[model samples]
Target: MLHILGLTANFSLTLQHKDQDILNVMSLVESTKRELQKLRDDGWDSLMAKVASFCKKHNVEMLIMEENFVDLRNPRKRTNISNMHHYKVNCFCTVLDFQIQEFKDRFTEVTTDLLICMAALSPIDSFHGFDKDKPVRLAKLYPDDFSYGELLSLEQQLDIYIDNIRRDERFKSVENLGDFSCLMVKTQKHLAHPLVYKFLKLVLILPVATASVERCFSAIKLVKTAARNRIGDQFLSDCMVCFIEKELFDSISNEKVIKKFQMMNERRVVL
Candidate 1:
């Protein structure tokens, strides 16, 4: 799963398994750790690689959230300077003006006939919390038109867009489906992608929980020996690689176990 900017946007992989969840959980934990480390080091390129690897191994699919200007920390990135006894660390977000130049360069280097990208010039998180860091310039790796203004909420914009598209002759019968919603269900529904909603609807109705992912992480910690005191990057990675790839014990096959226990009680074999 690709979790972008906290709980705001994310992607989850699915493998249609009947009973064994432990194996799936372990894979998730391991893959997540890898992705995080890679993102910090190599940016989007590395992120895509990890995402592909995880999906392939589990026989699953992936979706990526567009961390466009409207969503990611654009002009409102935080910065601070902390000093040691003799050393100081100045940490700041990738500023826009610099990023703009880089973006232009990327356009020049691309070999594709069609390069489509989602672009929006807006604040990071405007609907919820109040932030004090009013940004001036931000890092740009793409040629983004940075517009500052009182912007429309996502819901309002989407409503208009949907209205325009729904009138098209393409959507003949399912016209009302465009508005089919229980807006009161405040749980964040990622309608950005229809497949996400489909996946969520199924998951909500199922008795299954993410218990398997937890089990794998538990096994990860257990596999850590004292020699690996801190459970460093290498060990964590190895554990995930080993765990996620393994086939878990099937629950339906437990009839043998049940029958064996039943047979142990020779005095009371109730047919």
Candidate 2:
């Protein structure tokens, strides 16, 4: 039971998508299937049989009976076995099957499209596995942002953009969408691959984990405690943004903030 619990925890960690690619997800799934198959083939029944034989040979069963190690009477009175090893083995198999089925249901091929699109934005290996079609399909999903002509132009733009970024030493080490976006901004190449950028932006904002939403709620609770419960919605929103994106907020110069604030009002205090 403890072994199964450990496997469950490890499997959950594999599903976590922090800085992960589509290939990584697929690899984890394949590895999990292998582990589960091994578990099933090695069957808990065999382990139970060995354990029971060991206890019986050592007369440990007599000791257990005397010490009341197990409840001999079933509450339901459905079985006559002294030990419930068979039922426990069946229960373990059932749980393992359920976990496998749940994993398959949650990560079917249809759900991989977004992941493939996100993987195309990878900056490593010269973006060798980058798929233009995936991002194009992603753009088609947002018809408002991409017309047929725009998509064709985007394809051409992506070819150029990929070539440009590949040769540029500045982008060689970028590992995530956030850093890639900053690099684009720094190099002023955002307009070059507009559709790709849009798709990348969508990928960047997609919830990698529910914990991020939970974190936002945690921030709200902290920022809107009893003392500040009456804060206006706009102010609350601003506070949340600042709290959630503290790194970005920290990057802004106080001079730039003061200048913006001064521009917002006719009168301003000297800093």
Candidate 3:
């Protein structure tokens, strides 16, 4: 169990990209299956012998034995060290088989394709490693948002955009889609790659998990406690926005806030 857990912890650390994460997890599943099979074949006997030896050496062999011993005279009722090893191996194999099946079922072909498409926005390798077809497939998946013309133009736009980004020293260190988008916005480069910017917008809004939404609900529950149960919908929304994006909210100047509030309605006292 400790060995399995240690492997899991190591794999968890490499879960940076969605597509890569899926591949890593599948690889881990395969590796674990192979390990378990090997254990069942030969490792179990070796491990059991070593464990038995250790227990004997420490004079604690009785700790592993059953409280009531079965009669060795009756072959059907007797349980020996070999039987114990077999039982352990069978149990381990069963658990590993179930885990491998679960991993395969969870990461289907469609899921893999979607993740690979999403990972196309990675800014490494001068954006030359970008999977052009995957993003096209991604755009096709959302016809309502991306028109046929826009989808067709994405490839051309990506070619120009990637070339321009690679040539510009400022964009060399851009690590991910979010950073690339921010740089484009800051430099007003969206005009140069309109289609690419549109694609970036679509990618930015894609929800990776429901945990963030759930966290918002949890925050709402905490914020709208008994003492503040009667908060209006607009006020509650504002509070939630402030709570969720507290860093952005904190950056606003008091004067700017006061000026904005004064502009909204007439006030008796003006700052």
Q: For each candidate, give its TM-score against the true structure.
A: 0.20, 0.65, 0.60
lDDT to native, each model: 0.37, 0.72, 0.70
Residue 14 lDDT in model 3? 45
- Give the range where candidate 3 is weakest over 10 consecutive residues by summed lDDT: 14-23
**Pairs of colliding residues, candidate 2:** none
Candidate 1 lDDT, 1-271, residue by residue in tens: 2233331122133423433232233444445445444444456455457768989999986543332222134546432322221111111112222333443453342211111111111111221111112111111111232223212232234444344434544333321211222221232334442322332233233333344655666777667768767877886887776666566534335677677777887755442
Candidate 3 per-residue C-alpha lDDT over 166-270 given as tens digits, one digit per residue, 9 for 90 to 100: 889988888777788999999889988888888889877764543455568889987898999799999999989989777798899999998999999998999
| Candidate 2 whole-model C-alpha lDDT, 0 to 1 | 0.72
Ranking by TM-score: 2, 3, 1
Q: Which ten residues in a row have the lowest lDDT in candidate 1?
A: 112-121
By lDDT, is 1 or 2 better? 2
Which 10-residue window in model 2 sums to the lowest lDDT? 62-71
Ranking by lDDT: 2, 3, 1
In terms of TM-score, which candidate is strongest?
2
User: After superposition on all CA atoms, how large is the RMSD of candidate 1?
Assistant: 23.6
By TM-score, is 1 or 2 better? 2
- Best of the candidates, lDDT: 2
